[model samples]
Each structure stands twice: as C-alpha cells, then as structure tokens.
Target: MKKHLTFLILLILTAATGYGQSATSDADSKIVTFRFQPGKDMFVLKGNETELTRLYSLVDEYHGRITAGELPIRVDGYCASRATEKANLHTAYLRANRVKSELITQKGLKEGDFVTANYATAYNGDKDVVVVTLRIPVKKETAVVKEEPKTETRTETKPEPQPTVKEQPAAPVTEPVTETVPETPAPVRPYHFAVRTNVLYDAMLLPTLGVEWRINTDLGVKLDGSLAWWGGEHGKTMKVWLLNPEVRWYLLHDKRFYAGVSGSYGEYNIYKYMVGNILSKDTGYQGSLWSAGLTVGYQLYLSRSFSVDFNLGLGYVRSEYDSFGMTNGVRVYKDRDKTKNFWGPTQVGINLIWTIGGHK
Candidate 1:
C-alpha cells in the first residue's frame, strides 16, 4: 500500500511540472504584427481588405510553425478594419485561413503552431464590418564557447650579435606633391527695364498733349499725359501740346531713378494780332496757325509706379493753315502753308502710374 501511494504522488508531480513548463513557454513567446486597410478591389498591402485577409493567413501559419517547433515560434498578427464586409463570420474565418497559409508558405510553419485571433465590429458608413487580429509566437536561442587555459614555459638561449658597419648618409627624401583647386565664378544678373511714349497734336493753334508709359523691371506698363500753352502781346499767341504713350526702360534699375527715352508727336498752334505802322494807322491784322513736334524725357521714380519726369527733345512741326484779317473789315490773304521745322524742350511734370498684369 505504501509503495502504491508513493508511486501515485510521483506521477501527479510529474504531470504538474510538464503542465507548468508548457504554459510558461507559451507565455514568454514573442510575436510580430501586420496591419492592413481596404483598397478598390485587389489585395493591396497598403490599403486593401483582400490583402488583410491574406495577412491573417500568413500569421496563422507562423503560429502553427512555432507550436510544432518546425521553426522558432515568432509572435505575429494582423489588424484589419472593423468596417470590412461580412464583418463577423466571414472576416473571422477568412482571417484564420489566411493566417494559417501565410505561416506555412512565407514563414515555414508546421503543425501545433500556436495562434490567437480576435474579431471586432466596424462601421464604414455604407456597411458594418469585422476586423481581425492575430498573434504569432517566436523563440530566440544563444550559444557560448569556452576556451582552454594555456601553460607558460621559459627557455634560455645565447644571444646572436649582428655585425656593425660605418653609418652612411641616408638618401635624400622627396617632398609630397599637392594639387591646386580652381575658384568658381560668380553668376551674372541681367538688366531688365523698358520705356515708351505716344503723342497727338491738333493742326489748329492749340495745346499739345502726350501720354507716357513705363514697363518696369521690364515687366509692367504705365500711362500719363501732358499739355502746354504759349501767348504774347499784340495778338501774337502760340500754343503747343503733346499727347504721348511712352514705355520706360530702366538701364540701371535701382527702384528710384530710371533713365529712358520718350518719343511723341504733337501739334502747335499760333494766333497773331498785327498793328498798323505809323504810315498805315487805319488797319490791323489777326491770323491763325498750326504745326507739330516730337520729344524725349528722363524719369525719376518715386513709388512703385509713380515718377517725376524731365523731358527735352526735338520733333518736326508742320503748319497746316493760316488766316489774316483787319478789325475794320479789311482782309489780308496768305496761302495755307505748312512749317517743316518746329522743335523745342518739353515741360517737366510728375507722373502717377498704375501697373497691370504679371502678378504670379
């Protein structure tokens, strides 16, 4: 009876030990995790539901391999969106199968591999779905080698003396060569700016007006105009005016001062009042005249599109018509002639400009 009792106790103890070992081993195992989302149709590793299923199978297979000890069990898993189609039953089964296959083909899993799967519901607007999670096992092993102790031995032997000779001068040493590096050149910047002007004049003795425009930084357009009037005693009156459309080109564009040429055509008009000489006190004369001219100007910029312009240039002004008459009803006749030469300085003025277009 005593022997039987002892034997029974030993068997129980052995079983308990085995159980503890198995439990502890599984508990200490390591695992790898995989995540996936849904894509259009194909199994996409990045954003695809189909790919998620495939990942599940791979994990399952890995778990099997670890359990069977065919490969060191490395923990692995897959996380899928809960919103996937067939959220519950379909997703669960699909994940299990996929995980199993993955372990076998990709990770070389075998039977008895351990795998744990979790399923959850997800709502993706259009549908309610299931997400699957998997965990796989992994194991690590290390080996160390011990080296044998070495013994020390001592032996005495006569020293051999080398023959000595007179010292000779060592050969001259050569200096190391060095390469020279070349310097890089600086980049060149381009000059950019433009100016233009247009003008119109009347054939009758009237003021001339001109419009000026500047294209800044070689990238914009500006417009402005001017007029001038002239008068003298004795009915001798003259009026010159300019109409100009101008573009400015800044040679040295410093934002403030711009040097450019202005071109314009203008009309000049004159009225003359004549007084009779001492001998012919009975009569006086009056007449009308017309002509045209061109000019150029330099501009100093004040703001982004505003400038003060100083203009001085020459242009051809032709007289179109002329008339002469006396206040006493007496008339003097002169052909309606044109003057070919009419040139002079243009007036100084400030220009307010606006730029349009070319804002990137």
Candidate 2:
C-alpha cells in the first residue's frame, strides 16, 4: 500500500510538471511587434526595456522548448505599411530573417526547424513596425500502465500440506490513457496582383494614359502614352504624340526609393512656330524624337491604396525634322530636313497613383 501511494505521488508530480511546462510555453508564445525608426532599418526599443527583456527571454524559452521536444516551430515576420508595397514586403522579410538569424547564431537554434514567412503590410497597419510569432506543432500519443492491487496475504496455520494452490492469477490489468494535442491553423496567402494609374497625365493638358503591372514586391513595369492636338488661324497648328515605357526596381525595404530605365518615342509638328519668334504663316517643323534614359524616383503613400510618385529622367535625345510650308493649313512645300542630337533632361513628372486589384 505504501509503495502504491508513493507511485501515485510520483505520477501526480510528473503530470504537474508537464502542465507547468505547457503553461510556460503558452505564456511565451505571445505575438510581439517591434518598432523601428521611420525610413530606417534599426529597431526602436527605447523605454521598452521590459519588453525587450521579455522578447529575448521568450526567444530563449522557445529555443529550449523546441530542443527539448524536438518539435518544429514556425516564425512569421510582418511589416506595417510604408512608403511603398515593395519596401513593406522586403522589410517584413528582413525583420523575420533577422530574428531567425539571431536565434540560430545566438541561441543555437536549428534553421531547418523554423519556417519563416513575410506577410508585408497585411498583418500590421502601424508604420515602421515588425511582428514576429512562433508556432509549435501538435502531436497525440497513448500510454498503457498496469497497477497491481494491494493484497494482504493471510498465513493459514491449518497444515494444509497439500500442494499450496497457486493464488489465482491476478486479473489481467488493462488500462488505456490517451492524450491529444490541439492543432495549429494554416497561414493565409499573401501574393496578389495590382494595377496603378498616374493622374499627372491629366493635369498636363495633354490627355495621357498609363498602365502599371507590378510583377512582384521589388519590380514593376509601366506603359504610358500622351497626345495633344491644336489648330488656329493663319495655318497655325500643333500636334504631339508621346509613348513612354519604363521598368522600375525598388532598392530599399520600405520601397520609398526606386530607379528605372525608360524609353520614349515622341512625334510633334508645330506649324505655330516660325523663324525669329513669329507666328507661322506658311512654314513649320515636323519632327520625331527618340530617347532612352535612366530615372530615379520616390513615392509617398498617403494610404493603403493611394500614393504620390515623383520621377525625373535624364538621357540623350535624337531628333529628326523636316520643314513644311503650309498655305491656310495646306502643305505647299517642304525644305530644310535636318537631324539634331542632345543630351539632357528628357522627362519630369509628379503622379498621383491609385492601386487596384491588391489587398487593402
């Protein structure tokens, strides 16, 4: 009976230890979002000494749990909305990667045991912040134990010299205990398509249209076109057509800064301009210009779907022109065909953009 009591006590203690560990793990699994400096990559922990301490402690505990249980952990990284979508996505990945690096290098965590994901601005709405979370897999098992019932054997003095009948075999012990662990839910998908428009074209008085296809978080392509036509008395007329296409690359995590290469073809005819600053009465120049250049730009996002883009392009322009003499808007003669070349600013624009087809 004493042995049974001791065994019961040991079992109770073991169960209590397991429960305590489970509770500790739960406490350490909180979702933590850390702040960073605006437009910078450094974490901001000032006045958060307690939180910082707790964060490190939680990481250590997580590492210990995984090591002890040999269980896998999933660590998800997230960043809040920033100046650009690309920056947000990249920043989130970097933040999560940084944490993973620390755990592996400082806490002796195995890299393969962790799954890291970047949720970009989808998880957090705050600016310049990063969130990290840990998840453990659930497992179920069963254990069977047989407990012998306490028996007080009484000695019979009746010299029953007959072969002592062996005590009836103890009833077959059969007990099954089952334990099940809760399962973790799967993560949400993060990738999507987005379309954007540049409003600056409308303000130019020359109606323009643009389409942008964002290939991913770091790269995108845009195609734009602008057109204008005007006519007045004395054979004066002006017409312009421009087609511009560019490919952009986001260089920073916040995606506020970008560089692009653009190619443009422009055709114009200005019968309104004559020699010596006079209004054209019969002569004008018709020309086509082709330019290829590089541009650097910046974007400031006002909201999840709205932003302003500023771009400037500098490159070489090759222009070919022919002089046409017109009489009352009728071409009568042509002369002075020539070609001119120069290297300078080719484009300047400020655009208000609306992003569509992407998650808010």
Candidate 3:
C-alpha cells in the first residue's frame, strides 16, 4: 500500500508541473498587450514600446504571421466610467472601431480579418485600454467508435383511434391609436425703425427731428437735423442749421445704456439790429462749425412703443465766421473775418422716441 501511494503522488506531481509549464508557454505565446492613455480618440502605439522602436513593430510582425497562417483576430475595447453606462459603451465601441479602421487602412489588413468587442468599463477595472488579440482555433478531439455484433427482436402491437377536441376562436384585434402633438411657433427677432424728436430743442422752437434705424437688438444708427430762424426789428436776427449723425452700440440687449460717437456740422447767423442806435439794416456774423465727439447715454422705455433718450456729448469744434451788413435787404461782406477752435461739451439731447416697426 505504501509503494502504491508513493507512485500515485509522483504521478500527480509530474502532471501538475507539466500543466503549469504548458500554461506559461501558452500565455507567453498567445497574448500580446499594449496600454493606452485615457480619454483619447487616437491610439498610441508607443505605450508599450521597446527602446528605439515601438510595439507597433511587434504588431507588424504578428500581422505577417497572421497573414501566413490565415488566423482569426479580435479587438477588445474598454473605457473608464462615464456619466452613464451608455456613454461608456459608446466610447468603448468608438475606440474599438477606430483601432479596427487603422488596422485595415494603415496596416493593409482586410476588413474581414478582425472582430471587435466593447467591454464598457469592465475587465479593465476602471481604466481605458484597447486589446488586440490573435485568436487561436481550438482543435476538436476525434471520438473512437466501438463495434458490436447485431441482433434483432420484433414485437407486434395494435393501433387504437382517439377522439379530438375542437379549437377555440381567438379574441378580436385592435389597431394602435396615435396621439396628436401640438406644433411650436417660430421665434421672432427684434428689429425696427424709430422716429424721435428732441423736445428740449422744441422749447427753443428749434424743431429737431431724429430717425433711428436699429439693425439688431444692440446696434443702431441715428440721423438728426435741427433748423430754426428768427428775425426781429432792431436788426436782431438769428438762423441756425445743424446735422448730426451717430452710431450707437447698446451695452445691454434691452438697449437701456449705450455709448457711441457722432459727427456734427452746423451753421448759425447772429445779426445786430442797430449800429450806434441807428438801424444798420442787417449787421451780422455768420459762422459754420464742425465737430466730432464721443457720446454716452441711457434710454428709459415708457411703453411698448415709446421711450425717452437722454444723451451728452463732449468734443472739439472748429468754426469759421464772416461778418456782413445788409443795405436795402441786400447782404454786404465786412473786412473782419475770424476763425476759432474750442473743445468742450458739444451736445445735450432729451428726446421723445416712438418706435415704428420695432419689437418690445
């Protein structure tokens, strides 16, 4: 009994050693691994590269071997946990597909040569990797058949008739019903034209008219003109004409506050009625001024179609003046001519605005 037990133990040890050696050899020969950086669209071949070359070289060598042996291949893809399982699955699928595409296109492999699978946050334990494996076909063992001598025996039995039950009818079928859905309306854009009058200038009877064209919610341009003429007995006469054009950029989408620049050109005439208490007909100085300025302002919307705008301007003005006197209502030019240059507040406006075609 002792001799038989010792022989059985030796046989078991030998078998275990042989199985371990076989498993190690199979692991070394069958599997090749490469690591990948997480959250990247492209695969890096150098992740498990050797010095001065890449594991990509090993892939090429394996490709040649596969082509020679006509072996099947598999690509397994994995991704770390994403916000949702579907996202992880999709990412892993995309990575596997990308690898398969590169293998077919760049490595000159046939599209039919590879199959892909996405592990999806599994197998890698929360790390991202793509594994390319060459599949080894399993060999099936042949079964041995044992032959035996044939003998025959026969027995006779009588057939009997059986009664059958009738089948019941199925229930009536109903069509599926679909629910109606309401349609959504399209969005409206805010664009329009507004006409505004400067009421402050109206106090001076200097009717000022402004037209603003708002191309968008936050950008606009305005053109304004003011004209007035006054004449009295003692040769007291004044005439003024002004043209101002400005570009406005609203700071808010609602167009509450804005800053812009303007260019203005104006001409005015001031006449003195009497020269030394005697009516000299018309003695006056006519001057023309041009200015360019920076402006800042705010608008208070009173209603859907009405608003008030208050703006201030400061800039440099250049003016040229010519003196003249009139005899028999005809103008006569004087020898005195002057030019002036000054910089200060150039404009103040309080305007009442009415929107014509703009949105609220």
Candidate 4:
C-alpha cells in the first residue's frame, strides 16, 4: 500500500512540475489577439490598447533587439464557422498574410521573423480572432535610460570657445542630412460588392446603374438597369427602360479580367434616335427588344474603391416594333408588329465601378 501511495505522489509531482513550467513560460511572454469582422482580412485596432496596437508597440519597443538577432513571431489566423471549410481556410490564409505584410512593410520587420499558421478549421475559440504570440518579453533590455544618463548630462558643462583649425569642415566626416524615406503601404485587394454606371447610356440621356455581387473568389453576378424618359422639342420623344443581368467568371489571377454571359430585355419608344447627341428625324418606332449575348471584358482597378471596365458582346437580338410617321404634326401609324432580327453587336459598355464593403 505504501509503495503504491509513493508512486502516486511522484506522479502528481511530475504533473505539477510540467504544468508549472508551462505557466512560467506563458507568463514570460504576452499573447496579443486581434479581431476581424465578418468577411474581412484586416484586424480591428481602433479601441484603447487594442491587441493589434499593443503588438505594434511591442514590436516598436523591441525593434533594436529584433533586428540585431532572430525574433520569433507566430501568427495564427482564424475565421467564423458561417462559411464552408474551404472558404474559411482561404480567409484564414489572407488574414495571416495581411498581418505579415503590415509587419514587414509598415513596421519594418523582416519577413523571416514570422512563423505563420492558418487555423480556421481547427480553432474553436473566438472565430474572428487572429492570435499573435511573440516569443520575447517587453523588457528585452534591462538597462533603464534614467538610471545612467540624467546625472551625467547635468554634470557636463558647456563647451569652451575653441579655435578653428581649418578653413572648412570636410564633407565626409560631417555626414549629410540623410532623411529616412517611409515605405509605401501595400495595395488593398478588391472584394465583395460594387456599383457601376455605363457612360455610353448616359450620353444618350439614359441614366444607368449597375450592381455587382462577388459570390466567391472568382464568380460574381451583375445587374444593370437603365432609364430614359424625356420629351423633346418638335414632337421628338425618347422613352426606354432596360435591364441586363450577367454572370461573370474571373479567369485571370489578378481578378481584374473576366468573361460573362448576359441576357437583356427593354421597352423603347423612339420618335427620333439620340445619336451624336442629336434627334435625327420624324420617323419613329415603338419596340420591345430582347437579346442574349456572350460578353468578354477586362477590368482595371484604378484605386482601392474604383475600377474601369470595357466590354463588348455579340449575340442574337430580336425587336418587335410598330412603324410610324408624323403627318402635319399628327401621329400616323403606317404598320404594326414589324419584326427585326440582328445577329451582331448586342452590347457595348465602358463602365466606371465603385467598390463597396471592405477590401478582401
């Protein structure tokens, strides 16, 4: 019985020692945590003493020691459980890369200092947090500045008048005023939603608005709506409304270039065509138009919040209209239900897009 009790006591002691060592190690370092919003890669750092801010302060304080030798930094990223495992994993990867980018580009830390892991699937804690564990303590240096310098500065007297030994101070020994240039911030990645307007329609007095929703990394849907309802001088009437919906696939690695399949429907009444900003003739047509097309476009991200797109489409177009002509300032309908079919140039647009939500 005594032998068994002794073994149990030794086992307890060993367990306790192991836990104590872990506690001490954890106590020696601080674990800072930064949180992300849903579908965002950037962390929140606005509040007082936020984890991200604290991490920056810590890095700033220990920068000298960090650059002198190897500084171990571990960044673990996570996402919420709302998305699929693959989506969560992708978000986690972006979050970790974002932190590493800011640390290297903004804070002047070296990339080799980072040890990164994405734990969106494995993490069970706060789903929106990225935990940063720095292996060094805040007090990387023990010598306090006040302990050795204030009294010595007080004891030193002003310099006595000295004779000039040379005619000029040599340029080599007296270093030039070398200003440290700041590093440029990394470009923001586009994501989520966007609003756009087509200039081609606007020139014809038809105001248009388009909305795009990014469903995933590569696929998206866009809808464009246009309206022009106005009466002109000399009985020239222009009234139309159009809706175009498209599904797009971003094939390029930059996510700027895309291909889309589009369908359109419109109702229009044109007494005179609005071409070259002029109403041309007295002949008019009232029509319902339908089109199905394949569009190919390339997008250029001009800024974080804006992009320019150029696209052209070719497909089948069918229009059913009633031909009419004005007689002595009176309407005269000559024929009805005249149908026309065209197989080319269904869509053309130069769109200016504004991105919404946070950059992904």
Candidate 5:
C-alpha cells in the first residue's frame, strides 16, 4: 500500500509540472489614445490629430502582420459620465466606429481584423477616451523531456510566518490635485459674407441693405446702400439714394469692436423746407454729395449666426445742389449750381446682421 501511494504522488507532481510549462506567451502591446471633451464624440483636431495620425501610420506598418493574425488590433471607446447611459453609449459607439471606419476606408484594413469595444473604461480610469492597442501573440511549441525516475521522501513542512508590516500614516496633502486642461480650439464661425439691414431705417420706412465680406479673421470689407424715395405730394418731395463702402479692422476676437475708414456718395432731391415759418419761403434743394469718414462700431452677438451692429462715423462732406423756391404754386430757381462743404457726423447705423454660411 505504501509503494502504490508513492507512485500516485509522483505521477500527480509530474503532470502538474508539465501543465505549468505548457504556456502561450503574450508580448507587451503598444497603444495610441485620444480623449474627447464632455458630450463630444469627436476629439479636438489640434490636440488629437497627432496621435490619430500616428495610429494610422502604425496600422499601415503592421498591415501585413495584422492580416495574417500575427498582430491583433483592438479599439475601445469611453465617455465622460456627464450624460445619461443611453446617450453615453451612443456617443461611444460613434467614436469607436468612426475611428474603425477611417482605418478600414483610409488605411485599407479589413474591418474583421479588429476587435472593437464601446463604452469601456480607459487606461488610468479616464472617462472620455478612444484607445487603440496593437498586440503580438507568441505561441510556444511543447517539448517533451524524458528523465530516469528517482526515489523521493515526503517531509512535513510548515508555512513561513509572514512578517507583520506596520501601517504607515498617510502624509497630509498640502495642495489640491488640479487637472491640466487642454486649450480649446475655436469652433466654426462665420467664415465670410454677412447680410444686414438697419432697424431705424426700417422704422422710418426707408430701405437699407448692407453686405460684408470677411477678408480674414481680423478684417472685413463692407458695402451699404440705402434709399428714401417719396413721391411729390403738395409741398413735400424727397428722393435719395446713398452708397457707402468701408473696410474694418476688428479689435476683439469676438468681433465686438471694429474701427475703420469709409467713403459715401449720394444724390438727394427735396422740395420746400421751412422752420415752422408762415412768411418764410418754401425752398427746395436737389444735389449730389460725397463724404469720407473714420468709422467705429460695436457688435453684439445674439446667436452664433446673428448680431447687432451699431456704427457711427465722423467725417467731411461736399455737395452740389440747385435751390428752388415756390412762386404761385410754380417752381422758381433761387440759386443754381451751388457748392457746399461741411464736416460732422456722416453715418449712423443700428444694423441687424445675419452671418451667412455654416460655422467654421
């Protein structure tokens, strides 16, 4: 009985050793990770494009190995805990799938070659991230070694006593752990072209329209036109059309303050004018005028695509006109080809601006 028990014990020990030696080796993996802002599926271009491009380059480098099942790729998506579970899941899904699609479509990799997961915890427990990992697995062949059987003796063994470790008191923290935040790139804005009309002109039954071409981020060119045409009725008649063009230099990043120079030209006709005088003759003036000025403006944004612009100009004006006076309900010229030059406030506008096109 004792001999049989010894043989069983040795057989069990040998089997256990062989089983432990039968192994699959896994190599360390390389990873590329990019993070998103809260409630955002896409990472900011300025921050994550480098890592994403690198990941694509790596995919290209490992294309053959990956297709042959030698190097496997895995993509995992995670979201910040700021939204409901369903929303988060959807965002994570988009993030993962978009990246995979880029690899498949742009890099010419097969979709089936990747193992993709959505809404997973990222490395270091980051809440919002997409991680791509590449791993190489090594398979080892089994080798059998034969040895002569040796005699063995069983001895009673006792476990070594684990040394008692004294718990160290944690040091008091002096400063709060502050997370470093990446600088946000400006979102899409009005790239070019803005249309506008003046509220005061509309109120006065005058038609005013303005167009702006944003030359660049800090500069713009604007053209404005207005008309106040009224039919001749009794002693009152007025007709006018004005064209103004300006170039602006925006002083604020939000396009709030702008200072620039502008030029204006107009033709005007008015019949009969009096300062509440019964004896004063009703006189009329018809002329063409031109003005140039320095303009300063303030813009208040109502939405991403709308703003209110208030601008004022101070400048010089020159005009040529023919003066007419009413005589027995007939027109009589008092002065002809008269020229006048003046300097004062030339333009004022309270404009409603609609920025055209999509955000940048």
Candidate 6:
C-alpha cells in the first residue's frame, strides 16, 4: 500500500505542474495590457512603460478625474473594469490617442498639452479596463482699434447789395370786388283737413260732427257740432244743437304720420215742447248746453298733400234752461226753481278726416 501511494503522489504533482505551465503560457499569448485615465490631453503608446507611469501618476494626483487649467476631461469607449487582468491595452491606447488627436486638431488645442482627465473602470469577462477623458481650452483674443474720422469746415458767403432806383408815387389802392347772389324762396306746404261723425252708444245722446284744420304739422284747430231730435211723454218733441272748438298738439311729427291730443269746450242748445192737459197746458223750454273733454287721434298720409285723420274723445255734458213757457194753446204752470240737466259717465267717439293741404 505504501508503494502504491508514493507512485500516485508523484503522478499528481507532475500533472499539476504541467497544467499551471499551460495556463500561464495561454494567458501570455492571448491577453494584452494598456493604461488610460478619465482625463488626458495626450495618449501613451501601448507597451511603453515610461509613458504609462507618467499617465498613472497624473491620474493618481487628479483622483481618477481632473480639469487642469481650462481643459476638460472625461472617460469614454467600451470597457469592463479598471482591475481587468486581461485588458486590450492596444485598443485602449488607440482610443486614447484618437481622443487626444481630436482635441488637438478638431478642438483647436495644442499637442503635448497637460490637461485634466477623468477616469473610469469596466470589466470584460475577468479583465479590468481603464478609460480617460480630456477637455480642450479655448483662448480669447483682443479687439482691433478703429481710426477717427476727419471733418471738413464750411465757409459762409454774404449776399451782394442791389442798386437803388428813384420811386414813383404809389397808385391809389383799388376797392375789393364783391359778388351778388339771388336768394331762393322757401317751399310752401299744404294744410291738412279732417272731419268726424260721432254717435253715442247710449240712446239718450245725439250724434256729433267734427272738423279739423292743421295750421302746421305740429299744431291744429278743431270744430265740432251735434244735433238731436227727441219725442217724449205728453207728446213732447225736443231739438238740440251743440258746437265745440278745440286746439290740438301733435305728439309725433314724422312727415307721413302724426298723433296728437286736443282739449275743447262744447256749447249746446235745446228746444222742448209739451202737449196740452187738463191741469197744465202745452209748454216749451229752451236752453244753452255745455260740455268739456279731451280728444286723441292719429293722421296717416295718403299723398304728399292729402291725408286721412281719425280721433276719439271723452267728455261731460250739461244743459241749463232760463225759463219755461206755454205753447200750442195749452195752459202751463211755472215753478220758481230753474231746471238744470247733466249727463254722462263717459263720452267716446271717432272721427274720419280728409286733409287738403300741408305737404312736406
């Protein structure tokens, strides 16, 4: 058993050594290395230990990122981590060099400039990768001077004196001329005329006739008359007549249409006769009647010089008799008291008109 254990131990040790050598050889052949930082103005060539040490020192002082002077730095490109054992130093260096070239050429920066850089780490499989960034500075320029402009001075010239001539006496001033114009006569407008027939709805009242004349478009005058005949108990027949005059005011004054109201006083006359009887003879009575009222109506134009008018009115009526007398061979008895008559709750009536004049 001891002999077998010794042989096995020797075999295991040889195999382990061979495996280790193979692993080391493969790593050396397949993997490459490089150094970068987040901020840098220049790139170090791959496998250049001297440049790598310089970059590392700069990166360490700036703490993985730096902005020295006016330059800006940042890390870019693909990477796994900073601690990558199998990093592609060649590709990393190429990328860094491109960044530096871009800053110098495209960004208008000087070559070999020391600029702040930023650094980062990434991992690819089991490899750590490092990146560097750098910013270029911008320079300011001074402005150029402008020359002052020269101005020219101008000289003034005086006018020459004119020769004097002997003056003749001035002619007498002429009077201003005036023009004469003919005056135009004013236009003439025709007058308006209206007539109305009014009959009370109640049986005791009489029908009335009214006429109106417009003195002007805004003012007018009215005249009215009424007549009635009545037969009562004891074979008595009565006749009555009333006349009224009024002044009117037009409320609206449009050319073709108008409306107005009027105030008027009425005069009435009555004649009455009674048949004969045994105790009293045929008797007669005569009186003057009075009435007062307001009227309102409108006028409509049928032509330039003619128009139609309509009106309605309400008023009170009263009759007074001086004395009573007998007639037609009848005996009569006269009372000492005089007779007075008053009638009306209201009076309403309308008028139709035919205007003759007053044209606008």
Models 1 onward score TM values of 0.28, 0.48, 0.43, 0.49, 0.47, 0.32
Q: TM-score for candidate 1, please give it.
A: 0.28
lDDT per residue (tens digit) for residues 157-239 in model 2: 77664343344446766678575433322211111333444455555446676777777667888888887787677666667
Stretches off by above 4 angstroms in model 5 are 1-191, 272-281, 358-360
C-alpha-based local distance difference test score of model 1 = 0.40
Better of 1 and 2 by lDDT: 2
Off by over 4 Å in 1: 1-216, 219-242, 255-263, 266-269, 272-298, 301-306, 315-326, 329-335, 342-360
> Residue 9: error of model 2 in Å?
28
Q: Which candidate is the best by lDDT?
A: 4
293 in model 4: Cα distance from truth in Å?
A: 1.1
lDDT of 5 by residue, 256-325 (tens): 6899999999997776422112224477788899999999999875554787999999999999998888
Selected candidate, larger lDDT, 2 vs 5: 5
Q: Per-residue lDDT of 1-360 in model 1, one digit per residue for the tens?
A: 999999999999999999998777653333333433432211224444455556444444444343445544332223244455445435444544444443343333443554444444323432222233333333444343434444344444747544444444455555686854322222111112223232222223232333333333432233344354655555444455545444444343223334344454445444441112321343322332332334344555333333345554444333354445444343464544533345554333433333322210
Q: Which predicted model would earn the best TM-score?
A: 4
- Residue lDDT tens for model 3, 1-360: 999999999999999999997665543334444456666645555654541133245445556545454665677888775667777777788767756654543344555777678866765464676677754544444465544434343434636534444444444455686854322222222337889899988776578998998876668899999987878764567688999999998875335789989989999876762221132434577889999999999987555578799999999989898878767777778845688899988788899999875344
How many Å off is the CA of 212 in candidate 4?
Answer: 0.5
Which residue segments of model 3 deviate by more than 4 Å?
Answer: 1-191, 272-284, 323-335
State the C-alpha lDDT per candidate: 0.40, 0.65, 0.69, 0.75, 0.74, 0.47
Candidate 3 at 243: error in angstroms? Answer: 0.7
Give the lDDT of residue 263 in candidate 6. Answer: 38
Ranking by TM-score: 4, 2, 5, 3, 6, 1
* Candidate 6, 52-162: lDDT as tens digits: 455444433432223223333443444434344235444454455554443332222333343322223344432323344333222234354544444444444646544
- Report clash pairs, candidate 3: 234-273, 235-273
After TM-score superposition, the amount by which residue 191's alpha carbon in candidate 6 deviates from its true location, in angstroms, is 3.8
